[model samples]
Target: MSTISLTARALLLDMDGTLVNSDAVVERVWRGWAERMGIAPERVFAIMHGRQGYSTMAELLPARPMAENRADNAVLLAQEVADTEGVVPIPGAPAFLTAIERIPHALVTSADTALADARMTAAGLRMPDVRITAESVSASKPDPEGFLKGAAELGVDPADCVVFEDSAAGIAAARAAGMRVVGVGARAASLAPTAFAPTLERVAVTATADGGVRLAVSP
Candidate 1:
């Protein structure tokens, strides 16, 4: 496959599937919740990734009170924070972060500050100076709030930003923010992001002379 090239004034990153692989903890916690709630596990799993816990709970139990979802979401977040046995940095993630240290970039994740810190630390990844965590936004992924906030914080036009994501919600959020997306991993392939890569390992980043970032993504 030909290499896909992209340029941007800044880069927006998603944490869970993009930088850290926390699927193990996510599945364990959400699966248990599904079992207790008598909901189908597959349905719960379908919308779990790349979203804030409370948002997932709300979607899974739409008729349930927001208060109940928020309460349960808090409990689930705590459980995820405490369990990091399988959390690890995505392939090339450490190098990718290092490569962008001097470039304009911000983490746009659905995780709250605590969970973000825990997972990033567990994966041994450097946290970006600018981060839009769950607490920073009133709306979740697929809403564009987080990505828009990240672009604003980075002082870059949304159209000049490139997003790296691995889930449907994240890609949609980036698109809604009017940014180009370099979809990462299997989850993003079918989402029709501007570009696609199987892993961060297939992506190369460089600083452009115009104070932008350039990405060369392999198929």
Candidate 2:
């Protein structure tokens, strides 16, 4: 496909499937929960990505109390943070991060502060200076709060920011926040992002004269 170019004043990035590959750890932890809950694994996996654990639990077990879901989520987060054996960066993530290091960017993820740190470290990726972790927002992905908060923190208008995400919830959130989205990885292709790339390897970033960013997205 021909390269598609897009411009933005700032970037909002999702951590899990976008930059870091942590599917192994996620499956290990959430699969067990799925089995214990007697819900089909496929059902759990479908809605798990890009959402906080508690949110996922609340969705799956609608009758469960929020307090219980929150408590279980804490335990799951601890388990995930302690086990980073298979966490790794997505292809071209290091170079991509380096290319945008001096520009305006922030990490907006469902992982809490500690889990985000652990996974990023395990993947050998530098955590962005500005982060909107689970703790930083009252709502999770698909809510638009985190991305909006990220734009505000970077002093960029929502319309001028581009969100990089790999899941339905994240993409929906970006769209709700009034930002264009660069969908990353296999999961994002059918979600109708503003632009789609198989990986960061297909996305190139350059600073513009207006202090924004120009992205060249390739198939």
Candidate 3:
């Protein structure tokens, strides 16, 4: 595919599946929960990505009380911290992150603050100074709240921001925020992103003369 170029004043990035690869632990948690709940693992995985644990629980166990869902979500969060078995940064993500360090960037994730912290640490990714976690927004991905909050906190207009995401929910959120999105994985392509890449291996970030950031996304 031809390269896609994007220039923006600020960057918004998703944590899981975008910058970090924690598929093993994420799948393990959901599959275990699915089995215990007498639901299919496929059903759990389908709604698990780019969404808050509580939200996923609510969707999975619709008849359950909010209080019960909250308690179960807490347990999931705790398990995530202790289970980083296959956590690692995506290929070329370290350099890509360094290249944009001087620019206005925020980590916007559906995971809770504590869970995001643990996973990022396990993947050897330095936590960004600005972050929008599950607790940071009343509504989660597919709602546009987190990305909107991230852009606002970075003092950049939504149109001036570029988002990196790997899931349909996150991609939808970025688009809803009026930001151009660079889809980060194979699954992202089906979401109709502005740019799509299977991995960050060939992605390039350059600082433009006008103090803007340029992302050269290669296939």
Candidate 3 positional error at 201, Å: 1.5
Q: Go through the candidates in order and give the C-alpha RMSD of each one to the true structure.
A: 0.8, 0.7, 1.1
Ranking of models by lDDT: 2, 1, 3
- Number of the predicted model whose lDDT against the real structure is largest: 2
Let me know the TM-score candidate 3 reaches against the reference structure: 0.96
Candidate 3 lDDT tens digits, 30-147: 7888899999999988888998877888888889998887888889888988899999999888888888889899999998888899988998988889999988998878899999
Worst 10 residues of 3 by lDDT: 184-193
Give the Å error, residue 123, model 1. 0.6
Show where candidate 3 strays beyond 4 Å. Answer: none
Model 1 misplacement above 4 A = none
User: Residue-wise lDDT of candidate 1 within 46-113, one digit each (tens)?
Assistant: 99889887788888888999989889989998898899999999999999999999999999999999
Count of clashes in candidate 3: 0
Give the whole-model CA lDDT for all candidates, comma-separated: 0.92, 0.95, 0.90
* RMSD of candidate 2 to true structure, Å: 0.7
Candidate 2 residue runs with Cα over 4 Å from true position: none
TM-scores vs. true structure, each candidate: 0.98, 0.98, 0.96
How do the residues 159-195 of candidate 2 rate in per-residue lDDT, one tens digit apiece?
9999999999999999999999999999999998889
Deviation from native of the Cα of residue 74 in model 2, angstroms: 0.5
